[model samples]
Target: MEIRRTPVLLSWICLLLAVFLIPGHCFYLPGVAPADFQKKDPLQVKVNKLTSTKTQLPYSYYSLPFCRPDTIVDSAENLGEVLRGDRIENSPYVFEMREPKMCQIVCKLTPNEKDAKDLKEKIEDEYHVNMILDNLPLVVPIKRLDQDSPTFYQHGYQIGVKSPHSEGKDEKYYIHNHLSFLVRYHKDEQMDVARIVGFEVKPFSVKHEADGKWNGDKTRLSTCDPHARQTVMSNDNPLEVEANKDIIFTYDVDFVESDVKWASRWDTYLLMADDQIHWFSIVNSLMIVLFLSGMVAMIMLRTLYRDISKYNQLETQEEAQEETGWKLVHGDVFRPPTNSDLLCVYVGTGVQFFGMLLVTMMFAVLGFLSPSNRGGLMTAMLLLWVFMGLFAGYSSARLYKMFKGAEWKQIALKTAFLFPAVVFVIFFVLNALIWGEKSSGAVPFTTMFALVFLWFGISVPLVFVGSYLGFKKPAVEDPVKTNKIPRQIPEQAWYMNPIFSMLIGGILPFGAVFIELFFILTSIWLNQFYYIFGFLFLVFIILIVTCAEITIVLCYFQLCSEDYLWWWRSYLTSGSSALYLFLYATFYFFTKLEITKLVSGALYFGYMLIAAYSFFVLTGTIGFYACFWFTRLIYSSVKID
Candidate 1:
């Protein structure tokens, strides 16, 4: 039975190691559509004349164009041609942006009576208010280059809209907000000129810069709140047909010679569609899922199944000692945990937290919530933490009961206050440091007060209620009854020290994410983007494995030392992961970041609290499960007459 269980556990460990290598193993998939789903480029598109004075296209000059090919629609074309009016023989081909939002109609360079009168009529019709011609800016000339064409020649002029967010709001420009461009080749040289072929909206974005160590720039909109700014539109009629879909006019002209030629669109698009980060994430997620599944199966089959089978075989003899029923050692089980009372509370709180997190993650994976919802992850998790008040209260109260603590009142009071108080103290100190620096990262005084109010008003009451319920229930019964005279403990091995064993347990989980932590910090403080849910999920599995193995190993050592205080050890053994995580964050700030200000440092620690709390919970759950099983194993295997 032991051999079977040992192999199963080993198989799981081997599988975990194998999965950890997935980030480097997989290939990325190509994009299904253009980078942005819309007709416009997500990034700024430029068109420059080879002989032009301007180094880059001015925000004004480049106009978006719609091309009608005789046969197919061109959605994204880097190379385009400028053509002369009506004549195929002498027309000049100039490069232009084929995207609809890039399109613009310019007035003639030297206005005739027809041009001047037409301009006045067009401005009045477009703006519905008189606009001055002198104020109108001259267009610049150039062509957009794509993969096939490296460069295109200069031309007469180009026209484009000034961005909506340009320094001045009063400028008069006929911005085509909802327009998308498409190109379709003419079916025949003599058919109806050309019809609108493709449709899509323009992509837009505002500029942002990181400010100082904390990177809080109030001038820019928060990424956390995407809808903070307003967008301008071309028309007042909400139901007005969009430009790409609603074509107002069409005209046919002779085709002129252009340098651009059709290339294999597949190769062009595939190159642009690849996302390395997303590729890595998918592969990593697959490996971790397989790894964890294997580990879980091995543990259940080898250890748990064997223990249950052995116990079942002895049912007749075990039934004879009905008073025992495996947990006759209730007195020893309640032995006081060594070290500190505060640490006990801390570990218990962590256990409760981990329980909530697992349930939340499972829900998220099942599609109850998505990662795309910015704060939806944090918000869902916070609600789960609140709901777990019961577990915190129960674990703390029951452990205290086992310590021969007759003061249920004191136990209950401490159970209710300990975790919350520690959190508040840590938070208050960090906030004070932030307030001193006047950093944007500092929590507003009102917000701090509200947080306090929530803690006391909401969490404290729930915890107190949980404590009341926990104490109302009977203390947990131990499997083997304790002897009136305590048994002599055998001399422990050198590694049996609680501190030493715990340190070993922490290493696996920390090793799993030590490298990934830098990237996580970069995303948060350095303003780098990371949406690698797969890597995150893998780290999560590693944390579980580390917690369980470490706890089991430590529980064995504690049992050998005759320290029946395995209850608290089991909780704290895994929970030490939180401490390691906090240490890692501190190290990351000093080694990886250039952050100098104390407030940013304080905010960093403030963020660490959230991580620490999460780690504590996750590790705590691992310890609890491991110790629970270990205890059951020993009770079932030991000879009891």
Candidate 2:
């Protein structure tokens, strides 16, 4: 009886553990649980932020003088949503399931000068109004003739349009005062339930006129009337938005049954051009890897093997001394590199980044971080980075010990602060600019304090603990002993120059991922979904291989040239790829984006600089470890006595 009771208690504990360990979205099952609705059920339409690609800024939906609900309440947001400037709030627009309502009057607003100016600015900037229904974002569908699937989706509808004045003078702003909403739902005949799968809208600007004396009834409008069955046309006189002008807001809702299921409803929204480009990127990266693999194989199997054989066969000290190249520099090759402290910090930071990305990608590939869990990716990344401080400190401490550095605590402090400090300063400056612009993209003060707390209160203490543990362990042993006097490096050819070799080595790694980078940039800046974590993980692996191989190849060349200063060279070799990344970003900005504001341009470059710097550290660390391993292997294989 006691044994049976023990098993039952253990089983109950296991069940509770599983429930808490699983992702929040997993409870909902197949792609966010369906919200079932019966006929005539009230469906609340929630308004989100007004976003503009040109400015890369988001404003609240009610920032403009539009129709408002009696009491506005912001929805609860996750950390990622807050960081991304998503401000979702309850709106007055409500729809009934399977109910069609035409020419429904929402409200009327008379704009002041300030409101008119703000609306005009948003129109000129091409701001789009985002709304949500049943967790599905509203989109404007576009039909493409050349595609097999004829329709593509634009995430949100434009707030208004700037048109030339009737007299062909200056441009005038025309607000989209009327919206035609189409909600598509999947209905289960057996269960007698319906779930919304898609939300679409077609907006129009109608200068509505009242018949006879104007009443509060919407059927009295001449432009759109439900009783008369009069609908708003595209060619109807547009409503001009100006100071002291009345803007009548109206909408029509039509529900249609769709064949798409609740599980696969997000498919249409996530669709892009094709997977051909991704495959092309993979093939291109594979080609680089194959080429580098051939080079590395030749060096290892033929050149190094031959050198080792010849050296081992030498019976006299004179014969051994006659041999030149890498064999002559075994002593200085393991010597501590210049700026060892900085190198340790960078390597530690890279380890932190690598752990964060690797774990995040694994979770994403496992379907833990689904699109339904909005902002989960970013949130996971931040938390993972913070927790990875332990690894960062440990790695830095071990390297510092290997370098024979006396102050382990100093190095650990540097490792903990250097990288994050640079990032925080840049982020703070960018946030200040956004705040001055009155954009929702600016992180609030509370969030800022939270970030600071996560860094100092959590990450810093973890780093100190890791550093202590690492310092208590014995230092790593070098394969070859270093001499008291450093060997003078021989003259190197023009191609063997550090700058030339580093720049040349970076090209291969950059080529490995530039295509994938384009799609990533598009997803972030253009407000599209990026749910291809599997492919991204593959690319990431390929990128690591390419960086390591390129750096190893360059390090071999430098070693053969009798240059023992390979540590920094190895790092820079792969890290220089970031330079190309920044240059490509600049090119992308000019060609792909239509950013006209100086602030927007500054923001783009500033954020891109941070990305490039991180890339530099990540790739540089990969290269250093690869070269370090290569040197140890070769030096250990040969007789160093």
Candidate 3:
């Protein structure tokens, strides 16, 4: 009986272990036979990258293949779907690869004589070879993604155009496109395969020209464009062949097994772009740091020392220090600012933005958020911002109440809804436009409603809770007493004018990060992968330091001029960096981008405004806090009567 009971216990233990292991292993061992594995498809074809040979730039393959919206079979795309950054289209026009001989004709570029003549007539009688609007050019325009890039990430095109060069007197020869092949050996897989790498502009033979056969020696099979070599074109510029050429495009495909994974295919290109831009950014940021540090050091060591000594000597010497500088306006410096409530709200929003930025950057550096992860960065940012709403409300409510106010409810409401509501309204409008265009980048209606629910249900309630805690306490105690009557501000010098000083301070911080701005814009509009979050995090820290130091130095100068209007001036001085950022973006748009559509231009500027406003809030808050500490330290140290 004892032996039977012991065996039963051991059997129960074995059963429990099997239960745990089966669930983790998909429980397929019982249902899936070994024969079933042989029936599954061995491989799948995915949409690869689009690239141009002339510019060596990657583009979205979908951008070039113009398919009619009415012909689309499916709809209801979401922001998360776009963020996933996969080839969203299921059509073969976007991506399809198989045996080269199995390629099918997708498009035919037959020249309509009437259409060509109409386009020629529309050309402004510019005397020379014909030039058109390029809207229906023989070549295609494309945009690509950060992730979901193709193998090798090169380019290939087989557009047949009429070659001016004749094979022999009357024998006209048309320019033909050939796909370059690469022979690859797979070590681990023990197989060999050939792949189509790119398009050959000129394919020639090495077994003697008269043989008309393939050759290993690289040579051009077609005539070079003499006029093209003479003229200069921008990088990734559109191709313009002699008008009225009927270009028939064809495809050649092949694949080779390799140890290299898909993720590392574009590593070389991204590394090169990052390395060059990172060095330039570091050098520019160092120069700005040196200038800002020099100014701050002067104020701390020379200016502040002399003023403090003079005041101290006069105090003990039974002499009165002249009331001509910053001390003269001490009575009004801490007097609650006009629109204190609004300023509180701005500061709160700034704090929230600042916190969200730091958290996002931190997550990015940790590799938790990445382009490959598809909406990981954005989803993280939105979640963080929602949770961080508590801080925004608390900061605003605490500051507002500290100003001897009783309107905690008003402060909380604005803190929770003001900027977020405005952003959502604009976002929905833009999304509506995308939906109208039937773009895959549009967010689904259900996702938008879900976002609204998160905002109102979770974020708003958290804000209210934080405000309640903040208002429960008494107004913050002042280190120095305020005079019953406000002191008169002395006339300021031209150099001390708020706007002039702001322009100077703003330029310095902007200069520190402007080089970085170029790379960021390239990553966004150009769809290049940005994996250098470590460098970005460093730049962010430098920007904060530059803003704080510059604003503190400027605030000191304003006080020296007996100006007590430093409340708004202090915030705007550092916050002015955003204005320069916007101006620089406009400059970049006109000079760097080839965007021609009116809607694209509008979208570019519209999104830039949102970025600038967020920057203003972030930098402005930094400046305000630094000045606040500086004022408290100086006033508390002095013997004010």
Which residue pairs collide, candidate 3?
Answer: 59-143, 59-144, 60-143, 60-144
List residue ranges in candidate 1 displaced over 4 A.
Answer: 1-334, 339-344, 362-374, 402-409, 557-565
Q: Please say which candidate is ahead in TM-score: 2 or 3.
A: 2
lDDT of 2 by residue, 1-641 (tens): 22223444543443343233321112112234468999999999999999989999899898899999889989999888989999999998998899999988888889999999999899999999999998889999988887777598998999999885443456788899899999999998778779999999998988887766656544368888776544585535888888998888889999999998776677778755576777788889999999999999999999999988777776346677676878889889989999999998898888888898899876675555767677888899899999999999988899899999889899889988999999999999999999999988899999999999999999998888878888888999998899999999988899998889999988999999999999888888888887666567778999999999888888888888889999899989999999999999999999999899988888899999999999999998999899989988888888756
Per-residue alpha-carbon lDDT of candidate 3 for residues 308-409, written as tens digits (9 for 90 to 100): 777767777655655557777778788888988889888989988999999987656544554444456777888888898888888888888878889788
lDDT of 1: 0.44
lDDT of 1 by residue, 266-348 (tens): 12111221245544544454454455446656655775466456555665664535532223443465345465355446655
What is the alpha-carbon lDDT of model 3 when measured against the actual structure?
0.58
Best by TM-score: 2
Instruction: Quote the RMSD, in angstroms, for model 2.
Output: 5.5
Q: lDDT per model, in order?
A: 0.44, 0.85, 0.58
Candidate 2's TM-score reads: 0.94
Q: Estimate TM-scores for all models.
A: 0.51, 0.94, 0.69
